[model samples]
Target: MVEALTTTIQTASLILAGWCLVSTFRDRPMLVPHLVAVGVLWLLVIAQAVVSAVLMSGGEGPAQTLMFVSYLVFIVLIPPACAVWGFVERSRWGPAVIAFACLILPVMLVRLEQIWNPAGV
Candidate 1:
């Protein structure tokens, strides 16, 4: 895992979590801006996944390949699912849900990095 990409992903997720928190504090439902932010973040995650996959293909990966791929699939899934859940709920808690997911993202990415390069850090 590239440190730069990991930092980028972590930063993006933090920003997204901040946005969600602000919306939740204001008692606002999930809005278009939130969805758009999630979409952009999702794209970044996909890029990260692709890059990591390519690197892993070249054998630059952890021994637990199945576990790493499962994490990949999980991280790829959260944003869209939360977006849908947020939209469906249409309440302050919707943004809270998004905030929760965004919070999970960075931690998950950090774990992914560790799993990818256990000795790097």
Candidate 2:
């Protein structure tokens, strides 16, 4: 179960992304979708950070350690920063910004998987 949290993080990110997509199509308030998607993204990213810290402390490889730490920094900052920007914009593009973050997360997670196990690569 060394890489189990990666799966959890991926699932949560996908769910938030799906919610953002659905809300975008339904024409919901920009903030609603933004908050919902960003909220979940934030939670999962934080969890990932914690998990990464634990794994690194447990003596994972240098590449895996560094990758998770980098993703932690990105994941922690992006969503909240997007939330603030989205709030200020007050337009459809608000949620669109969140959707963009969702796009970034999957790539990061896949990289995270690689980080957890470069031997698999």
Candidate 3:
């Protein structure tokens, strides 16, 4: 967990997700940029995972690899989940689901950071 990246990127994502939610409520299905923004958010997440894994994997410390994999699993799922749910619904609520998930990113990132650096935090 990259604390700075998590805080900054996730907060930015929250704003974008808020926009997506607002657009969902006020506009058509295709008008929202929720999927695109979520994709970008995942890019950051993947990067964070990769960096953490590489650092932890090389060291002699007791790094829990499964935790990183778990974060990746959920991080990877988020974009597609949002896309499918949002697309299938074909309604403002589609973006609403995405918006809700976007709002969750920061919290999840924070948790991930805590997992990585539990003692200090």
Give me candidate 2's TM-score against the actual structure.
Answer: 0.78
**Best prediction by TM-score:** 1
Give per-candidate clash totals: 0, 0, 0
- Candidate 3 lDDT tens digits, 1-121: 5568777778877887878767776965734456677677778877776777677777722255577568757865776677778778887677787787788777777766666666767
Clash pairs, candidate 1, are none
C-alpha TM-score for every candidate? 0.95, 0.78, 0.81
Local accuracy of candidate 1 as per-residue lDDT tens digits, 1-121: 6778878878988888998999999999999999999898899889889998998989788888999999999999999999999889898989898889999999999899888878876
Q: After superposition, how far is residue 84 of candidate 3 from its true place, in Å?
A: 2.1
Candidates sorted by lDDT, best first: 1, 3, 2
Error of 3 at 36 (Å): 2.0
Model 2, position 113: C-alpha lDDT score: 67
Q: Write the per-residue lDDT of candidate 2 for residues 6-85, one digit (tens) a residue.
A: 67666776777676667667776466645766777688777777766776778755465555677668867877887777
lDDT of 3 at 8: 71
Note the residue pairs that clash in candidate 2: none
Runs in model 3 deviating more than 4 A are 30-32, 60-65
Every candidate's CA RMSD: 1.0, 2.5, 2.3
Give the TM-score comparing model 1 with the true structure, all chains together. Answer: 0.95
Q: In candidate 2, which residue ranges exceed 4 Å CA deviation?
A: none
Name the top lDDT candidate: 1
Model 1 spans with C-alpha error above 4 angstroms? none
